[model samples]
Target: MKKRFCIASLLLLCLTSPWIAVAQTVILESPVRVVTSSDRSIFPESWLSPDINAEAEVLQESQIEPSRRVLYKVMKKYPGHILARNLETIYVLHRLKYKGISASGTNSRRNVYVVNRGSRERYTDAWIERTFHAEFSSKLLRNFPQYLDNDVWKKANVESFKYGVSGVKSVKQKKALKMFDPSLHAEGFLYAYAKSTLENDFNSIAEQLFLGDSRFWSVVNKHQRIKEKTDLVIAFYHKIDPKFSRSFFVSLAEVESAEIG
Candidate 1:
């Protein structure tokens, strides 16, 4: 009986040891709920440290706005505990920091879409990514390596000015487009729109499907047959949203198309 009791006690201690070690190592100042959000697979295999520590490290090192740091800190401490949901946000911020985008005062002012929210409130990754995705897509659109032949960026600029987007491409057009301010547009399916507008007859209706509207589809159904534009929309949305399917935008567009049909 004595031997059996000792064996049982040893087994219990061994079982609990892992938890004990985790607890000791995870012992954080301020009882950080946000810092405690470690053990997630969302972080890249390379970050090496625990999540919350990385969060703190990122906040300390990254050039993300002062307002953002304050907001994240409040979120870490507050009742909303929104940091738990912001794993992708953190990752993007880290990547942005890596790219030195945060440090660019001119770049920061020109492009980002900042929305105000309460510390205790939560936001979705999609919401955050949609905003940040612009940075990526804009960069993708603007900087085409060896883009002199059929340059999409230049072509789009010329078309927008031709279409009377802010009244004619002027001498300052190149300077204006170079600035970060042109990226603030909430336009739908940007890549598709750029490509589609370049089509001789497709015109605005091809781009309009991205606006999440029906009337454009009606016009499309009645007047046109450019199937590639739809294909482009599907492809571009999947770029912005990895999980998006043809049926997803199709359904949204169908609603608008049906209404106007």
Candidate 2:
């Protein structure tokens, strides 16, 4: 009986040791991650319509107004790009693109644009821009599924000199490069929208946009600077549509860095 008791005590000590170590483990997670999946949002339908009167009528008639409206907007800070009178319309246009037609440019480079003639509001241009971004994101996911896998980011280096090795006209042939570099362009936008410093909690926005999770909106709501976070994320995403209307990047670092508190 004495030997059996001693063995049982030893086994208890071994189990408790692991628990003690686990209790001491440092859990480095942001407060932003606490957002529940129920917090995710699909932009409201009224946001897409250019006619405010029509939208209001529809809302009153149907008794439909979402509790939240994705809480993000993408538009041109400058004059040349598109503009939306109501921010919600931007997302509406995006949702519309999944069903609308996509037209690529005549050049070898694939520059896609959505055709939405039914839209009458001045903000129509901005909505179209939003659609362009949605289309580009869709294509990238289809063409480069590899980017979504394995966090190990692999970069390639290729140099082409105009001059030949033997001083011969290096211009053996100017291999006509494709219209654009989708990945590089996508990275540029991603970097631009990324919070200026690691301290900023913009990664929460990145996760929803790139990680295929809509719940990030709840995280945005928790932040004291909700508008700032929402504006930054949307502006940055929209900026890239015209230049890289075919694709964008969602880095592994971005996946790991989003704050949930």
Candidate 3:
């Protein structure tokens, strides 16, 4: 009968809709979901608007599990309330380029784009985890600039130091952006990349903070400038959430080192 056919059609539409499929794939444990699809519709309009020229490839199915594991671990470091209020999704890709330059990761206010390690890629698990923390911290800084006082951060640096115009410009000019350099720690910088911009400086510290490794602490303990910068970073996160204290970070570092051992 025509009534029976109409009912069947409605049921089929609901079952096969893309929205339904996407909803089912959502991660329930956290507010943020790991998105692997390259489909534009899968991303929110606001996320796409800012980076219209960004290009990405779908993440390989085999890489999804490992990528998700790393992402979830990084997300777990943040307070639940902070994650719920600030982050919505993380889009994993085999490759991601913005404005024709290859980038390890980038972010908008609510979403992050990260290139996952491919079979042929040389990226390590540590690099991927650092990328997530770095990019996510950039998003958080943008969302809550008041927590980080630029003058205070600058005061931690050498008197004559000045950051480059932008991270993109630094990349375009082929400036060194290495992740760490003990020499730079004496100057209140983690590496050459930290000089690219204030945001980059913040990101460098944030990645190491979230990483909570012994190497980072060793430098912070030995270098007064690095210690000053680290203190500011700790204060910034603490302002965002009181639970993110100096002791909390020290304990986090201890736990991470124990696991590595």
Best-performing candidate as measured by lDDT: 3
For 4-95, candidate 3 gives per-residue lDDT tens digits of: 99999988986665333333233334547777755555555654565545656667677877787787888888888888788888888877
Instruction: Kindly list the per-residue Cα lDDT of model 1 for residues 1-261, writing each as its tens digit.
Output: 999999999888866552222221111233122122122232344433443222111222222343344334332321232223222132222212212122111012122222222222332332332233333233323332232223432332423443223211221242222121223222322222232223211223222433345544543344222344444434544554454466664675676567667
Across 1-261, the per-residue lDDT of candidate 2 in tens digits comes to 999999999888766552222221111112101011110122134424453111110111111111011212222221222222111121121112211212211000132223333333322433333333444443333444443321211111112212123111111232212122233232321222222222112332333444432333333344434434445444454454444211232332243356331
lDDT-based ranking, best first?
3, 1, 2
Off by over 4 Å in 2: 1-111, 118-123, 149-261
lDDT of 2 at 31: 14
List, in order, the clash count of every candidate structure: 2, 10, 0
What stretches of model 1 exceed 4 Å from their correct place? Answer: 1-110, 113-207, 223-226, 239-242, 254-261
Query: What is the overall TM-score of model 1 with all chains considered together?
Result: 0.27
TM-score of 3: 0.83
RMSD of each: 16.4, 24.1, 5.7
State model 2's lDDT: 0.28
Q: RMSD to the native, candidate 2?
A: 24.1
| Better model by lDDT: candidate 2 vs candidate 3 | 3
For all predicted structures, in order, the TM-scores are 0.27, 0.21, 0.83
